[model samples]
Target: MHPRSSLTVLAAAAALLTTATTATAATEPVSRAQVAAHFDLDAEQQPENITVDRDGSAYLTFSFARQIARVSPSGRTHVLATLPAPEKANTPNLGKAFVGGIARADDGTLYVTYATGTAELTGVWAVRPGGRPRRIAALPADGLPNGLALDRRTGRIYVTDSVHGVVYRVDARGGRATVWAEGEALRPSTFAGANGLKLHDGAVWVTNLDKGTILRIPVPARGTAKRIQVHATGMPSIDDFAFTGRGDTLLAARDDNEVDLVRPDGTHTAVLTAADGLQTPTSVAVHGHTVYVPSAAYLTNKDPNLLVAHLDR
Candidate 1:
C-alpha cells in the first residue's frame, strides 16, 4: 500500500459509484432490507466486511477502527479482536490501517485481511475460537490486500491485492504467499481494482473496482489460473458480492448505497437502495436465504450499520 494521496481519488470514485447506482434506479426493488444494528459512527465503527456463521452470529471487520467484532443472533455485539496499528499508519488510498473482507471456515476459524502499509503487520490474520489472533502470511508492504476467500477443501486462502492488481495464495496453516494470478484485466484504471474474491464451482471469481466488471477464472488441479472471462459489466465502485445459491445469480454491494441482483445472463436489477438504510455498503454475505450487508459509511459518513434481508427462493 502506498501513502494517502489527495482527495481527488476519493472524489472520482464517489462519482463513479453514484453514477452507476443512478443508472439502475429505474429497476424495481426485490427486497425490503432493514437495519439490524447501528454502529457508533463517531467511534469509527465503520464495518468494511462481514461473515455469518451457522448459528446465526455475524463477524465483522471494522476497517477504520482496526477491530474485528461479532454480533449475536439477538443483536448483541462485542469486540473479538483488534489488530495492531503501525507506528506510521498511512495506507494506500485509505490513509490508515484497514481491516477488510472476512471468511469463516467450517471449523470456525476466521480469516481476515489487514493492510497497514508495513510488512510487519499487513497480511492475512487467523482468529480461532478461544485463541489469540495471528498473522498467517505476510504480504508486500506496498500492496493493499482488500478481499479474502478460503478454500476449506484444500486448506488454502486466496487474497486479492487492490493496489498491486494481483491475487496471492497461501496455506491456511500459515506460511509465505505466492502470486496466484496477475493480468491486465485486474489492473486499476484509477482508484482500485481486484477488490473482491470468491471460490466457487472450480473457479475463482473476482470484481474489479475501477473497471467495474466481474471476472471468472478457471482453476485447474495444478492451482493455476486459466483464461480470465468477463462475467458482468457496468458495475462501478463494487466492493464485494455473494451468490444467492440459485444458479449463478448473486447480490452485489456497491459502495454508493445500492445493492443489485445480477443474473447469469449478465442482466442486473437494483433490489435495494439508500432508503433501505444503506450508508455506503462495503460487502455482502449470504447465509442460506438470508442476506447480510455491512455499510461502512466511508463516503456518506452517515449511519454505519448492518442491513438484513431475506431472499426469495
Candidate 2:
C-alpha cells in the first residue's frame, strides 16, 4: 500500500462513513458532475477488467475476489459467478483460482479466462448469463492471458498474454488456438504489460498499462498489421477503456488514481481526478452517456466502492 493511497483512503472513509461532506476536487481541470451512486463491494473485490453490453449492463472481473460481477445502469450489482478453487494446492502462494480476460459474444454468452499457478489449470471459459461454465482451451504454461476481445463479424476471440507479450486467437467454438501477432511494437521489450483490448473499425485496440499506450493493430486478411500509438500522453497507469456511445471517444481509467476521457484524435481531458476521492481507479465502462469507474482502494483506509460519473456531453 502506497503512503499517499493510505491517507486518501482514510480521508475518504471519514467523509463517507462519518459525514456527507464532499472531498476536494482534483487539481487537474475536469468536466464536473455529481457522483450518481456508489456500488459497494466486499473487502476482497479487486476489479481488474470491465466490458459493457448494449443493454447498459456491465460485466466486471474481480481478480482478487475470484468472481465476476454485473452492474446494471440502475447501479444494481450482483455476483455472476465465482471461479472454483483447485482441489489441491499446486504452487506456493498461488491461490485456488485467478481470472483475467473477459468478453461477451453476440448471442449474449460471456467468455472469461481463468488460470492457476500451475500451467495445466490455465484456460478460457464460457458461461451463459445464468448457466454453468465450461472450459474451452488450455493456454500454454508461459501464457498469462490478461485481456480479451471478440470479433463479432468473424466470430473469433483474441487473447493477450501479458507474461509472454503475445496475442493469440481462439475460435468462437473454442478448439485450437494460434498466435495472431507478436513483435517489439505489439509486445515491446519495455513495459509491455497488456491489460485491456477492443475491436473497432476492423482494428484491434489494446492498452499496455505499463507503457501507457493504446495500440492499434489491423486485423487479419488485411495484409501486414502495424502497431499504431493511440493515447500515451496521460499518466503511465492507464488501465482499461470504455468506448462512448459515439464510438469516437473513450474513457480510460488510469488506476494511477485518475480517469481520462480520450478522443480518437488523441485529445484527452481529466474527467475525474484524485481529489474527488478516486483511489486507484481501475476499470471503466460507459452506458449511454454515463460512465462507471470501479476502484480498488485497498491501500487506502477508505472503503472500496464504484464511482459513477455522468457525462454532460
Candidate 3:
C-alpha cells in the first residue's frame, strides 16, 4: 500500500465509470451496506484484511497494531494473537511491522502474512486455536509480503510479495518457500503490486495495486504454473476482493473508500461508497448472503471499522 489521496482516486474512479460502466448494482434504490462494528482509531485498530469462519465470526489482521483478532457475529471482538513487534521497525514500503492478509484453515487454524523488515520475523505465521502465533516460513525481509491464500486440497500456502513482485509457495506445516511465479504483471509500478490473492477453480487469482488489474494463474497437479492471464483491468487502488456465490462475480475493496461489484465480463459498478461509512476499505469477505468489509482508515485516520451488508440474492 502506498499513500494515494482519496480525492485523486475518486476522480479516477468517476472517469472509469464511463468505460467500466455501472452495472445494475448502481441503480439499486437502497444501499445494502451498514457499519457492523467500529474500532478505536486511537488504538490503531486498522483492519488490513479479513477471513470469515464457518460460524460467522471474522478474523482480522490489525495492520499497524500487529494483532490478530476475532469479531463475533454479534459484534464482540477478542484478541486472538499479538505478533511480536521488532525492536526497530523498518519494514519495506510501510516502514513498520504490518500484518496483512489472513486465511482460516479447517480444524480452527489461522495463517497470516507478516512484514516486519527483520529477517527473524518477516514471513508466514500460523495461530492454532489455543496456541501462540509462530512463524512458519521466513521470507525476504526486504520484500513486503501482502496477500496470502491456502489451497485446502493440497495444504499448500501461496503468498504474494508486493515489493519484489513474486509469488511464493510453502507447505501448510511450513518450511522453505519456493518462487512459484513472477512477471511484469505482478511487478510494482509506483508502490505495491500483487496485493491480494485467492484460490478458486484450480487457479491462483491476484490483484495488482499498482497495475490496477486482476490476474489469474493456473496451478496444475504436475506442479508447473501456466501462463498468467489478465482477468480484469482498470481497477486502481484495489486491495482485496471476495467472490459472491454467483460464480465469477466479485466485490472488490478499493483503498479509495469504495467497493465495486465486478461481474465476470470485466465490468463493474459502485455498490458501496463513503456514504456507507467506508474509510479506506482494505479487504472483503463473503459468508452466505452477508458481505464483510473492513476499513483500515489508513489515510482517513478516522473510524476503522467492519461494515456488513446484506448481499441481495
Query: After superposition on all CA atoms, what RMSD does each candidate show versus the true structure?
Result: 10.2, 8.6, 9.4
What's the C-alpha lDDT at position 21 in model 3? 15
For model 3, the superposed segments whose C-alpha errors exceed 4 Å read 1-31
lDDT of 2 by residue, 1-313 (tens): 4677556534433332232224555323233333423444554666667776665556777766767888655556788988776565242223445677788887778888776655666777788868877778777754567788888778888887765667778887888777776765455345446667777777777777667777777785853345555555544777777777665577787876778878777777786877776767777766544466666663463555566544555
Candidate 1 at residue 152, lDDT?
89
Model 1, range 113-150, lDDT digits (tens) per residue? 99998889999999998777899899998889999999
Alpha carbon lDDT at 262, candidate 3: 85
Question: Considering every candidate listed, which one attains the maximal lDDT?
Answer: 3
Record all residue pairs in model 2 with backbone atoms less than 3 Å apart, i.e. clashing: 9-302
- Give the worst 10-residue stretch by lDDT in candidate 1: 17-26
lDDT of each: 0.82, 0.66, 0.85
Model 2: how far residue 193 lies from native, Å: 1.3
**What overall lDDT, based on C-alpha atoms, would model 3 receive against the true structure?**
0.85
Q: What stretches of model 1 exceed 4 Å from their correct place?
A: 1-29
lDDT of 3 by residue, 83-121 (tens): 998998789988989998899898899999999999999
Candidate 3, residue 202: the lDDT equals 77
- Look at candidate 2 and tell me the lDDT of residue 276: 70
Candidate 2 off by > 4 Å: 1-43, 87-96, 188-192, 222-234, 298-302
